[model samples]
Target: MADGSNGKPGQGLLGDTENHARVRTTALVIIAFAVVLFMLVQARFLLISLAVAIILFALTSDVIRFIARQRIGRFGVPNWLASIAALVLISTALLVLSSILLAQLNTVLVTTVSYAERAPSAVASLFGWMGEDVETAVFNSLRSVEISGYVRTVAGQAGNLMQGTVLVILFVGFLFAERIWFDTKMTNFFEDEGQAARATKIITSIIHRVNYYLLVKTVVSVITGAMIYVVAQVFGIELALALGILTFILNYIPNIGSIVATGMVALVGYVETGDAQTTGILFLITGAIQFINGNVIDPWMMGRALRLSSFGIIMSLAFWGAVWGIPGMFLSVPIMVMLLVVCSHVPELRKVAVLLSREGLPEDEQELDRLAEEIENRKG
Candidate 1:
């Protein structure tokens, strides 16, 4: 009604519609271009490993900074030295874990193969007690499953795991070097020093959140792993160390990690002892550790730092895992955490962020006041 052409209200609406369409199209194109570029790079695994390494570096850097703050070194423990130390520590721990796992794996394989061959009759007899049909079905299923093929695949991958580990360490080392110069590099991106400083502050906030989340998650995972290991040892479960390490690593993936770890430990228990009771005990112990870690320790440590919705985590896990596999699953939560942080800063995206978060933002004062007034009137 305001205008028919020069200053029309309907014309403004038309223009707004066109502008919204244009913006949506532009955003879509930009996202498509990014996906195309990522595919062209063809470095999914490398990128995932690098991302994980950088997160780890960021988490450890805080500890290094803390030490430097105490004047532990003359030159305040250069970032490079701190990074190198962190890398060395991580690498050494990985090596020790790999050694333990490989040894246990070899033993398990040998024992399992022997058991399968020599105790086939025993297994059949146990199944026979259930029913003739059940025994037939069990043996048929076992025969159909190629255990040797699976063993070979696992062994081959384990052999190559060392190479992957080395690549990750090297990548993390470079990330550390880059961290030292990151502030200086970021300054060059902005024409105004003030703008650069503001950008640095934003980046620092992001880094702090990422670092804090990783540190807390890592500590919780380690505790869970140690608990699993001790419980397994108490139960006389073979491959306890390997299962413990596996639990620790998998625990990084939320929700489904404990389920996988428990099932894996139970399978190993079954194979090692050929007893359902032992396997059940193993599952119970692992499940209990996971319960404590997931429900108790993690919530205490996270304490609103993440605030990710349960549904958001599950969806991110599925999406990233589809795109990047196991590495994707491991990095999904951290990436989602990063996205939520950025989203929370923007007004429009804040709504979406609220949906993605465990809790919505605080209620507006007007709404609260209206509710209060309504309650008082109702009482009157």
Candidate 2:
């Protein structure tokens, strides 16, 4: 029997003890994961606001830095001054956008109440072939729903939304204030300067990818919303504006959003006009629009930037949607991007990144590894 330390083909002195250690480690990991999951569910609102603020900060940080570099009559804008100005601008924009969304959502609720009286019959009409009894039962069941209770619930949620917006503003403000210390902090945390630099590059890459994804998505969503609005108006739908706004908001969610928006348009069309042929035509048109924008334009604009697997996307969507609800759905892809990048950089978690990525490769992992090695060799 040769010694393991000498690189001989023999078991170590501990023998199968290593297997026991692995089992314990796996059990501990599972317990830690369970605890983390519970905390996430409990503190969802705070975490969600923080995540939003982080994203907003990343998107605008470069602009703020550029502004800080300007020399106005030999007086360079200080970093703090640039940060404050950016915070103010962001706060104003957020408030305005929130107000607009609230107004739009309020309109939807009001119309929903009015349409509540009509929706049952409209929906029931589709089931007429199932027998008059079935149609009558559906209409009765729908009519029994308490619109007032729903309104009250939504109104309460609206208050929470306002609070969340304020929290996000505060979170962004703190992030901007802390931006100057980030480099120093990173340097101090890592013993090796090269490692610190690599970490910074990785963070920057994630931010850039997320920012680009958001920009392209916003453009595509706006285009889709406009087309939907025009179609609604042409069809003389009463809730044209509301439908457009909903479409815009929903399109922020990936995979399932476009389908929902298109189906919504078709449903509304059928409900309002009670014409099967008209509804079918409207569905076809909206579906075509969504397919063109979502499938064609969006991919072309994104290119290889978002090389996420379709199955992985759906899984992420399902998990986040279950845990965080609608907001989670909106933030799923960005979260997945962060996960993908982080996992790709970590050797042990590289397999997870492969699973998350489109082609079993998370970005240029080999190139980054090579670059890191070169930097280390140069330093040595």
Candidate 3:
């Protein structure tokens, strides 16, 4: 019943109608996203492997470019040849590393299974008041777990991982082959060359950030693993090397990785020594190492490179970890980085990007608002 500029009684109703329309559109988008996510989970094997291949390409593409630029004499190495050499070298290294890791993992599994048998006794000894019955119960509960079945499951998983690795290798090869014509394709696809260039810039930024993150993480994880090995040796832990390698691999999984690694090391320490003090000391040492590396060193090195919110990362980790398990957890950060970068460039998705970013900056939105206000003020 208030008169407005339109001088109509139903003006407010019209505004409410528009608001409801927007809300419905937003709800539809969310529903669509959920449906797509379910499909992705259903096809996780293919999608996860593809995601891994793309991340691997992002990590290595620049190095391949650098290799292509190098010259032995007057002529630089051809791009094709450089790509081939890089692929061959990387493939061989991966093969060797995979073999070594499989061996180490096998040894670790055997050792851990053997230790499982003694775990009840070790735990019972910790609680001196617990009688033989309690010990027997604990042993029975744990002994019911068929280690051979678990080993077979792990072997099957390892085989699947190898298959994923082969797929990734093939994907990388095709990506390399396409690198040359990518610019041409972009140019043809975009009528505006400037827009095409912007697209390329976004892609390049994604690659550089992902590459830096991976490189830094690998170095930090190796250092953490090495430090863990040293501490294990100092404490006379028997599975020192295996534990170290396991730590190195697990470190890729972010917050959960360090905790799991610490638990494993502590358990092994207790089982080996049967001493509560030794287990406590091992736990403390590993916790300190993880704290230093994960909280201190890793952040310092990454220092704004990712620009991803901590909460967003945890969400990504949980989502991907649930969808694709360990491999998804390992790739969560990189995938989030890609999403943040791409979304930031798209006008419609800029708000989502801001939500994903650590700083919560809305440079695009703020600039647009400022310009609108300036134009309105001049009109006034």
Candidate 4:
């Protein structure tokens, strides 16, 4: 029954079977993605805390190991002791930071009423050059919105940060408890030394890359935030501390974040002062800070360490923001970094890793290929 151009009956039958198998696999993948998405949204609180805990563990693991290797009067600092110290430090930091952030959030929320009342006229004046008609139209449109209700909603959601902090602390404690046995468990689960070793390498690679990125980002963000805070204080803005903290938090979101923070500062200044010139000056100052840090300092420091595509970052930001809100936005880059590492270490998923990377090549390209091949061969 095989046509001449279609080749022999055996080849044609095999091709049909392969196509059928492909279709079934694609359908299964789609279904699995849908289920995962549903769970991510439904269990986001727990999942987010888990994700944060994992990142914290990765960041501090090296420090803990270093401490554990030290000798105190001929007795080594035990791993358990190091773990307990780290847990205490981490818990204290999270709680303290959460408290400070909540205080800033409350201050901003409380002052929001006055700001909102003056916002429309000040905002519309920014577009004064566009013509009076357009300015009036903008003012009327802004006037129609209920700013109070929106602030109230944000204030309500902000309260959940305290609860999330507690959950993250609990998760980190358990992670520390189990960290020692993780390697043994992985080896047992894989039941093959080589495979287990490869798995461990992949996980370590992910942690190292993620930890480096966070470290560089934190330093840069702190500088940018501090400078912005100084500028706010110089301008006599009442919410200097809150603005600084917001800038620090938003800077973690990547490209879109700095822009949003600058615009927010400009708007707040205008609403408070009702002076276009002063607002314009503050806007330029904040924008310069963001540009200098983000484009200059950040790139020089990060170099090829990040290797993430700008468009890919925006896409990740949008998708995760839609799914998990602001927390998702903050976590997007880390999640993408994890995905890129995992995918690059799998031959079947290498193409996806390329798409996620900046220059169509994941880190240590040849090494990644070798590791992926080894994994595939082992499975085969």
- In model 2, the clashing pairs are none
- Cα deviation at 266, candidate 3, in Å, is 0.5
Instruction: Tell how far residue 357 is off in model 4, in angstroms.
Output: 1.7
Candidates' TM-scores?
Answer: 0.75, 0.90, 0.85, 0.91
lDDT against true structure, model 3:
0.83
List of clashing residue pairs for candidate 4: none
lDDT (Cα atoms) of all candidates against the true structure = 0.73, 0.88, 0.83, 0.89
RMSD of each: 9.1, 5.1, 7.2, 4.7
Candidate ranking (lDDT, best to worst): 4, 2, 3, 1
Instruction: For candidate 4, write residues 1-380 as lDDT tens digits.
Output: 54543656577667788999999999999999999999999999899989999999898887788788789897999999999999999999999999999999899988888778778887887889999999999999999999999998998888899999999999999999999999899999999988898888788767767887999999999999999899999999999889999999899988989999999898888877788899989999999999999999999999887789888999999999998998999999999999998888788998988999999988665675565566446534
Residues 125-235, candidate 3, lDDT per residue (tens digit)?
665567777767766666677767887888778877677778878888898899889999998999779878767767766766788899999999999999999999999
Q: Top TM-score: which candidate number?
A: 4
- Cα lDDT tens digits for candidate 2, 1-380: 45745674545646667888999999999999999989889999999999999999999987797788789997899999999999999999999988888888888777777777788898888889999999999989888989779887887777688789999999999999899999899999997888898898788768878998999999999999999999999999988888898899899999699999999889878878888789989999999999999999999999988789999989999998988888899999999999998898888999999999999979665666665465346434
Write down the lDDT that model 1 would get. 0.73
Q: Give the TM-score of candidate 1.
A: 0.75
Ranking by TM-score: 4, 2, 3, 1
* Model 3 TM-score (2 dp): 0.85
- In candidate 4, stretches whose alpha carbon ends up further than 4 angstroms from where it belongs are 1-18, 365-380
Q: Which candidate is the best by lDDT?
A: 4
